[model samples]
Target: MKWMQRARVGSTLTLALMVLFLTGCPKRPEVVETVPRAIAPQGEVGMPAPPPAPKGATSGEKSPTEVAAQSPEAKPTPEVGAVPEAKIAEAEARPEIAAEVKALGLALKDIYFDFDQATIREDSKKLLSENIEWLRKNPTVKVTIEGHSDERGSSEYNLALGDRRSRATRDYLIAAGVEANRISSISFGKERPFVLGHDDSAWQWNRRAHFAVSAK
Candidate 1:
């Protein structure tokens, strides 16, 4: 009976040893799971985000149309009633031109007269016609007919003859279509002789009507 009891105890000890050999030590318990965290969108956290746009402007900057409309072009200013310097110079030069025309008219030929005669000779008619044409061309010119006489004539008689000769020359111009207002007559008589000689050569040159020119 004691042997049976010892065998049963040995069987129990053996079964305990076998279970220990088959299994190792127990594992540690797993950690608890935390609640899911909210993540930021892209370019957040350690990575830098893009800079914010300036006030009143888009991210890409201002449009070309908006920039052009804000700026305007400047215009040039004009002077009022201002005359050019060149035109002022031209206005100042007009009187000199008129004087030149008057000088040219005086340089033309004079008409001659016969001794003690008031009538214009046929030979003198061509020269008178030329004078008339010149006067016509220079409408603004005025002329004086100065009659002279030979030294042989008496002073009083020479003056009378000179007056008649001046009138004769003036009338011929008037008749040939020269403006009567443009011509005037005077008598120099024997006082202003053209030549100082006693012969006919001197007398012939002294007895003449001379032209003097002026601007109208």
Candidate 2:
């Protein structure tokens, strides 16, 4: 009977040991991959997303630095010795500009007359003829002849003499084939003496017809 009791206790302890071993056994360690996740960028709350780029340029995705940038006023300078297209067009449009520019360089001299007479002096006629020729060559050029006189005569008499001298000068120019309209005459009389003295030399210098030119 004691042996039977010992056998029952052994069986019970063996079953309890088996149950504790099964419960305490460690499970195979799980080794699932743990790759890091990338977080997406957050956009502003109320701002709408940018529209997709156009079909062509967007495809290239070109850098802004790739192409040279130029503002409206940053035009390339013209090459040396090259005329600009705008200036060429202007020259073509205004043909008279050439004549006007040429006229700017032309110069004329004064023609002196006798002290008391309006007749163009013998020496002065030669100069007058040269002036006439210039007027003929530049038909587009107009001339103003200023008749001045000495301080000997009355203001009224000198003014009248001055007018006669200017008229005679105009008539001569007209007869020499210069356009009558192109030659304008004015008189200053003793009021504008060329020399401010009462001597013969001064009077001689003052009794003269002076010329000025302008482009038509």
Candidate 3:
């Protein structure tokens, strides 16, 4: 009977030891990898979005820098060298009579007459011949023969003498091949003396026929 009881007690101890061993050790926690979720910032509804950055220029389109560089630069006006239109118009409108007169006055010598006579002096014939040659060469030119006298005569007498002198000069020019229409005559008489003096030298200058040229 003592042996049977001891055996039963040993079996009971073994069962108790097995139950303690199973409950004492716990399972390791599972190593799970949790992924984080992204959260967006909150804003007011109905608000407009910001504008996008400007795009780069295409091959055919010009950039702001290129457009500015291609712009035309200001240039200064050039000075004109040609004759004025107004002057040319005026010259064409009026015959160049004054210019021709000035030219002939400068080129030819005056023709002188004898004291108290309408006849041209022998010495003045050569000068007259030269003037005739010039008139013949320039057929388009016209002339005005102005006769002057010494202050020794009366106004009426001097004026009559001057007319005769101018007429004689016109006749000589006409005979020397100058056209009659091209020659005009005028008398200044003693009213316009070349030199204001009472001497032969001064009288010689005053008693003269002057020539003025004009474009026909």
Candidate 4:
């Protein structure tokens, strides 16, 4: 019986040591799972997202359309009842042109011709001399000589005669020191008559050389 009691005490001590070793080993460090902390995006991390850049604006500046709308020069208004400069200049030039036409009519005269004749008459020489003197005084004035014939001849014949008459007048003016370049001659034949009649009285007036102002 003493041996058996000693065996039992040894077994009890061994069981106590095993129980303490199993319960006291710090519980295998508890296998805790830790999640990685979240980080913000690159440029927008802490900056409050820049207040959302107004509806149509860009980079915190007003949009081009909006800026233009607010500008003073966006829609300019012209003055009421104001004339354009071109219109004003045209209005001022009209009177000057009328004066030029009036002066031309007052300065130049016409000379008459005889039946089937291109040579200048004795009576017309005095008037032609006066015309030559006047032309010499106004060197800058350019004139055209218009020859007209009576309606007695054919259109072709009258036209030829009118051209000869005009050429005769032009030659006379050139001989009296007028520039050939300044005098242009044209023939009307019977197309344009000064006096409208088939009689000699009207025909005399119709056959003439008329001087007209070309330029100054």
Candidate 5:
């Protein structure tokens, strides 16, 4: 009976010890369903959120720097020597005036007359011939023959004489082959004296017919 009682006590003690050990034992690691620690958005980890962009900064408001950057007028300008498109077009539109100036001589001064007369003298025949040739060459040219007289007669008489001189020159030019339509005559008479004095040399200079050429 004592031995059976001892055995029962030993069994009870062992059973209790085994139960306590089993309850206190550590468990194998497992995937826990714990909530994960909060993480910041990308490109940031530990820093605080940037202060809300100063009021209207993010609301379509443009800064001075942004406005300047958007302006096309602020772009770098090209140099002056760069090709100018409008000037090139203008230069091409108007023909040069120098070409017209070059076509006419500085002066034509060979037309002469006889002493004290409006006659187309024998000596001036070659001159008239050359001038007629010029007129034929340039059919578009119109000419005016200005007749003058020496201060030898009354103003009225000199005027008539000047007219005769101019008429004689006109008829001669027409007969020599210049178009009559292109030639007109004007008599200045003694009103316009080439030489102002009352001398032989002055009279000789004044008695003359001048030709002035112009474009039609």
Candidate 6:
């Protein structure tokens, strides 16, 4: 009975030591969550991002469209109106051109022709030479060499003869260094006469070349 009691005491001591060892071993902590103090959920956490830039206005400097937006008072800027000096000079030269044409028209009087002949007369040749020189001075001046005839010949024949006469004058002017571009020829036949009389003197005057300037 003493031995049994001693054995029971030893078993009791062993159990107590085992329980203490188990209690001293590390253990996972239990999470105890406390109730959070109530407040308005501070809106949303992240800040609002800035808006994207306008299309084509990627450059740091303001584009034309952007500049207008920033300043409401700004008016629409017009494109520069400009003209070159040469064009202005050309515009100013118009009056001088008209004057030159008038001067040339006045310089040439009527030129006479022989009866039934389309040949350019000697005196008329001198006048043509002077006219050609003037035309050379002003290259832009255009002249129409019109051939006329007296009423004695048939209208058809006179027309043909008149054409030949005007062409002869044009050729002579060309030979005298006047550019072909500056001269032209036409035939009036006997339909129009500067002198209405039927006498030889009138016919002589009628069979001739008349000079006139073109309207600008």
Best by lDDT: 4
- Clash count, candidate 4: 0
What digit string (tens of lDDT, one per residue) describes model 4 on residues 50-96? Answer: 44456765676877888888998765335656676656767887656
lDDT by residue (tens digit), candidate 3, 131-193: 878777778777788889999868999998999989999998888778899989999999988
Ranked candidates (TM-score, high to low): 4, 3, 1, 6, 2, 5
lDDT of 6 by residue, 1-216 (tens): 999999999999999999999998999899999998975444456755556667776656787876777897965443445565656777987667777778879976667789989888888878877777777776766778889999997899999988988888889888878778777889999999988997997888899887766632
Residue 76 deviation, candidate 4, in Å? 26
Worst 10 residues of 3 by lDDT: 74-83
Candidate 6 yields a Cα-based lDDT of: 0.80
lDDT of each: 0.83, 0.79, 0.80, 0.85, 0.76, 0.80
lDDT of 2 at 102: 48
- Stretches of candidate 2 off by over 4 Å are 1-106
With a 3 Å backbone cut-off (N, CA, C), the pairs that clash in candidate 5 are none
Give per-model CA RMSD.
21.5, 10.1, 17.8, 14.8, 16.4, 17.2
Lowest summed-lDDT stretch of 10 residues in model 2?
65-74
Better of 2 and 3 by TM-score: 3
Over 160-215, each residue of candidate 1 has an lDDT whose tens digit, in order, gives 88989999999989998988998899998999998999999899999999888855
TM-score, each model? Answer: 0.53, 0.51, 0.54, 0.57, 0.50, 0.52
Best by TM-score: 4
- Model 5 local distance difference test score: 0.76
Q: What's model 3's overall lDDT? A: 0.80
As for lDDT, the candidate ahead, 3 or 4, is 4
